[model samples]
Target: MITRRRSHLRAWALLGALLGATGTAWPAEAHQARAQAPALCTSSREPALAARMSQDIAAALKDRDGTVSVAVHDPGRGLRCRLGDTRLYDSASIAKVLILQAVLGRAEELGRAPTRLEAQRMKAMITRSDNTAATDLWQKLSRARLNRVLREAGAQDTVLGHDRYWGLTRTTARDQLALLAAVSRRTQALDLMGQVVSSQAWGVTAGAPRTVKVHLKNGWLPRATHEWRVHSIGIARGTGTTGTAAVDYRLALLSHDNPTMRYGVRTLEGVALAVHRGLAGGTAARGFTPGHRISETPDGSVPSGAPGPLPPAPPHPPQEWGTFPGTVPPSRTARDRRRAPRRPRSRPSE
Candidate 1:
């Protein structure tokens, strides 16, 4: 997996060193996994886990049409898996995540908190995928402000929707990871995302253990050429198995040319389930032991009442961001494939 840049590479190296000190055999194992694994993906610390994830993800794509681009980040374990990482797809309502950030961030810039009505609209925008709410917020949110949010988040491949159509923005898996990383830091923003109506919370969080607190946003749209586009960006956290520290992971899955919305959803769900199993453990958490820290529980997991405060997680290694070979370019027929022809906008999501 490519780290986003040199800095991320250095950060990941630092984490590997820390893991070495902590009796975690992840660094060397991760290196070996990379050497042995296909270019599609890799995992650290556990070759079996990485191989299983790669197989499961590929199986999910088998006999399916359209493209599915995946990027998975596990900072605690120093793991990353990517397939078609930089492939561009329609943002659909996924851009609302950036809109949400712009709204809250603009409020902060204005030297005030988001007002009650703004907060309500923002919550509805994220939790219910409400289009009217998004439109209202978009009217008040300027492109410049949105650019500020994207720049702050390191969303390099994302282009703001043309003529103020946030849903139509073009983006890639790597860039969405950047947006999620920024959103993960703000308590109120993440809280709204976590409150997504159960009906709307259907993508990357699937099969995640109840112990994991999942905050995610999913979007889908149908068009003439690609048929349908479905995408999801998410952050999951739970108690790390090795210590009191928490497990921090972010995943982005993007797809287009699905025959139907449900098919696209299925493609993402299979990959997501495998991811949760691979990272957090399925049936039982594979690496878990009794009596771990409860003091700093971030995901609201049940506390073990162990004495010490939460240990710090391994330093988040920068993601591999070097140029990768498997990227699929945006389709070129409509508007240079930067975007599809504008039509009467449908509701932003399924």
Candidate 2:
């Protein structure tokens, strides 16, 4: 019996020594589970308001993975909150809004209205998150022109994509806030953004009071490296006492490395809900309700076999910009088959 006990003890000791040599052989996901949550960094002139927002935002992001950046501005209240607002992420379809700004700015510069083709593409690009339409506009506007618009908007932290991959452009929450402010003040882009297809209007609107007019743009793209980059920016106009212009507020939320698109959307909505509630003096607002009807399609109907709950394709294809004409191009699947299988290229998340 002593010898048997000795053998068992020796076996246990060997196992312990092996484990110690290798440290703990935990699975990758176990390490991820043990990772610390992100810290919320926020500031506002209104100390009480700032405290509330910081607490609310931190609570909303508790235990969530990935990185999220947010910036909020309420001019009437002189309130602002920024949490990781300067961190950059791939812009995805959100860049389409900037493209719209470029298109309008260029038209204003040239002292001409958008041509019929330009109007059509702009409509498709913003309202529907249409990649082909965005590509058409991106090619026409060129990188130099888009960069010029970014500069004019005072969005210093934004970087346009290399070549045709507009979705790959990098931007920060603070930069997006600048873009939102520009849209709010300018009529051209603001008018088109107001018509954002109901199906695509889920982010900032989720937390806003129903009476407020919401102009929003959302971008979502999934990549092998980041899992998903999802972003939303908007201007909200609150209903005030009659005979007064509504109090306008702007918010920008950018996130990357989300486990899924829905998770990212939920995170954004949570942040929005908190901000709107704080801005509205703790009044509760309606949550996100997807529109039954899809907008911006050829027939304004949801395409058959569309991925449920996933964001639409981003504003550029995986390939370089070719000779795109004014007309809307074919769907991605058809285009892929027509071309020779080039080397496997990184697909655009948007």
Candidate 3:
């Protein structure tokens, strides 16, 4: 009986060993299975959708009347699409977004939301694109503070020059899009945008009855070449009352430096419409329409030919300067003035 018991015990021990080995191998097999599986972003849904959006954005710029650079970002899905180089455009009113950000951050640092009066001015700056309000806030915010905010917010390509000039501050559509995306997610950065929008005297971008929730800021520099440019960054959240859930579409458009002549408002309307159509899954317009119509030789302004490649462009203008809509001008730093005036540098005597 003892010998039979010992043999049975040995058989049970061997079986237990085999089971343990199989159990350990199961995890390895599972990991291999996962590795072999296609990544979802790379698989069926998102990649294709992103590609389509990219195609649509490119087509829209081609069909539009003037020069434009656009960027769309869907952060949740890790999608980014661009239709132009990263060079600057006249910020027009879009710099208002930065002003808004600066004010809120300052307010937050002081441990309070802006007062009723301050909030009112901020709203006017953002929604109405009022230049005076923008200037007031710009003076209050200062370049040093604004730079700190940009650095803190992880905005790499954005810079604030002296407030009262068009080219003083430089910002790109991609940078603007990134800011809006972060705000749409209700990040701390967005809290600043919301606080400023609360005081808008009038709203240009949020006018739709569907109430596309826009947390935006715009800039225009009209004092310079009668050209107008607009810079806006925002999320078009659906009108909650209408039962439309917010779609995650972030937009940044720099429209200026084109041959067209219409004001920034007209150009922005086209951009907003394009965004709305994209969200609705509609294709962009086929033929071109200048976002602005320029007059030629004071008579036949309809110069017809293939629109040339977009001109080499500069960053959008800042709010303080009343100049070209979206062009950032060179600064008059001491170094800037030290160079010879408009003349080629002479070679050293050989």
Evaluated with TM-score, which candidate comes out highest? 2
Model 2 scores worst on lDDT over the 10 consecutive residues at 294-303
Per-residue lDDT of model 2, residues 158-249, tens digit only? 87776677777789999999888777777877878899987788778776765577788888776655666778899887674342446688
> Can you tell me which runs of candidate 2 are displaced by over 4 Å?
1-45, 240-245, 281-285, 288-350
- Candidate 1 lDDT, tens digit per residue, 95-177? 88888888888888899999999998999889888777887898797788888788889888787666546676788999999
lDDT of 3 at 15: 22
Q: What TM-score goes with each of the models?
A: 0.68, 0.69, 0.56
* Model 3 TM-score relative to the real fold: 0.56
lDDT of 2 at 215: 85
Residue 224, model 2: lDDT of 51
Question: Per-residue error at 19 for model 3, in Å?
Answer: 57
Lowest summed lDDT across 10 adjacent residues in model 1 is found at 293-302
Q: Rank the candidates by lDDT, best first.
A: 2, 1, 3
